[model samples]
Target: MRKTALYPGTFDPITNGHFDIIERALRLFDEVIIAVAISQDKKPMFSLDERIEMTKEAVKSLSNVTVVGFDNLTVELAKAHNASIIIRGLRAVSDFEYELQLGYLNNSLDDTIETVYLMPKLQNAFVSSSIVRNLLKFNGKTDHILPKEVQKIIGNMTSCTLH
Candidate 1:
């Protein structure tokens, strides 16, 4: 049987860190799905469409990966995609507590689903969606952290819609 994994996140603006995780994920699972969350509470800077498009473009070269927008329970999303594993990226020690809580919660919600944590490359480790947004707000150089495709999409925008 093919092993499929679901990687869910707001992905307000996908960073190199995200690419790192996805590329690494491709190695472990037969197929990987990037679930872009519709986080109403976060009031995202990028629209759901924009986030999905951005993710699609960024991962275009990669095989066995899908980019999708979802607004339901993650486990439900996983089930819909037939994903048995949930992939989470851990960038720092601070992220562990929250991610661990989420792992347990998701396991409680569906004991059949398993959560796996992976870390990005060292250079991309500290990069995150929030940090990318903050840098863009100030016209900061994010070339080191953002994928070229993301920089293009974000550049085309005419205004700042801070979350």
Candidate 2:
């Protein structure tokens, strides 16, 4: 049986940190699915379709990685994809607290699904979707946090054309 893992997130724009996590996850799982969550609670900068396309483009070179949009809970999505594990990225201690809580909740909701956390590469630890959004809002350079294509998308959304 193939070991599959689902990486769930809003991924308003795919960032370098996200790519790092996906790359690492691909190493552990036979297949990694980048699940973009469509949540009503949060208004994302990029639409679900946009996020899906961007994520696909970001991971286009990875044969074992696939991107898809999901409206269901992470556990449900994991079950649907036949994934035994859910992959999450941790950038700092603060992120761990919330992620740990979510992991516990998911495990409680479905004992068959497990959450695995991967720390971002040391240099990309500070890169986050929110940080990239803010940088684009102020026309700040976000090349360090996001891939070139993602930076371009955020720039377009914020009406800041990159040269």
Candidate 3:
């Protein structure tokens, strides 16, 4: 049987750090599904459809990866997708506390589903979607934090909005 993993996130504007995790997960699992979750409490910069499209474009080069959107709990989505593992990216110590809590919650909800953490590559250690979004909001250069394609799209969006 092919090993499948689900990497769930808001991916509001998928960053290079996210790409790092996806690439690593692809190596560890036969298939890695990039699942975008819609959070009710958070106001995302990009809509769900937009996020999905961006994620798809970002991962287009990875043949073993797939992207999808989910409105339900991540554990539930994992079950539905027949995924036995949940892939998460760890950028810093602060992320551990939150991911630890999530792991416990996910295990409680579904014992069969396991959470795995992938550390971002050194170059992308500081790249985060939140940071990229903030930079874009201020007309800051995003080339350092995101792929060129993503930076171009964000630049275009900001330019059109300012016009």
Candidate 4:
């Protein structure tokens, strides 16, 4: 059987930590779908098209990875992609509480689907989209924490553009 996993997130701007999780997920699944969520409540800095483009560019070298956008529940997205597993990245203990709840909720939504948690490299553990956004907002250097393509997008943007 072909094993497929779905990794869904807003990915306002894909970060190195998110990239790290994608790389690691590729090792365990035949195809890992990077689902960029069209979040309704949270307004993202980048448009969905921009997020998808940046994510595609960031993972262009990985043949087994695919980037797509979704505006539905993650479990529904997983089912649509024929994925039996949902991959969530765990950064710290604080992340676990929310992730655990999400895992249970998703599992309840679709009993056959399973949620898997993966941790990025320790160096990337501290990096997150919100942090990167804050860094960019203050003109703090975020090149070290973001992917090249993402860096370029933020590099060209003024603080006013983010809002």
Give the number of the best model, judged by lDDT.
1
Q: Give me the runs in candidate 2 sitting further than 4 Å from their true place.
A: 155-163
The sequence of per-residue lDDT tens digits that candidate 1 reaches over residues 138-157 is 99998889899988888877
Ranking by lDDT: 1, 4, 2, 3
- The TM-score, computed over Cα atoms with residue i paired to residue i, of candidate 3 is 0.94
Clashing pairs in 2: none
Residue-level error in angstroms, candidate 3, position 85:
0.3
Tens digits of per-residue lDDT, candidate 2, 1-107, equal 89999999999789999999999998899999999988657888777898898898788888889899999888988998899999999999999999999999999
Model 2 clash tally? 0
The global Cα lDDT (0 to 1) of model 1 is 0.94
* TM-score for candidate 2, residues paired by index: 0.92
Q: Which has the better lDDT: candidate 1, or candidate 4?
A: 1
Count of steric clashes across candidates, in order: 0, 0, 0, 0
What TM-score, to 2 decimals, does candidate 4 have? 0.95
Q: What is candidate 1's TM-score against the reference? A: 0.96
Pick by TM-score: 2 or 4, better one = 4
lDDT of model 2 at position 127: 87
What's the lDDT for all of these models?
Answer: 0.94, 0.87, 0.86, 0.90
Please, what is the TM-score per model?
Answer: 0.96, 0.92, 0.94, 0.95
What candidate 3 gets wrong by more than 4 Å, as runs, is 158-163
Ranking by TM-score: 1, 4, 3, 2
Please identify model 1 stretches exceeding 4 Å from their true place. Answer: 159-163
Poorest stretch of ten by lDDT in candidate 1: 154-163
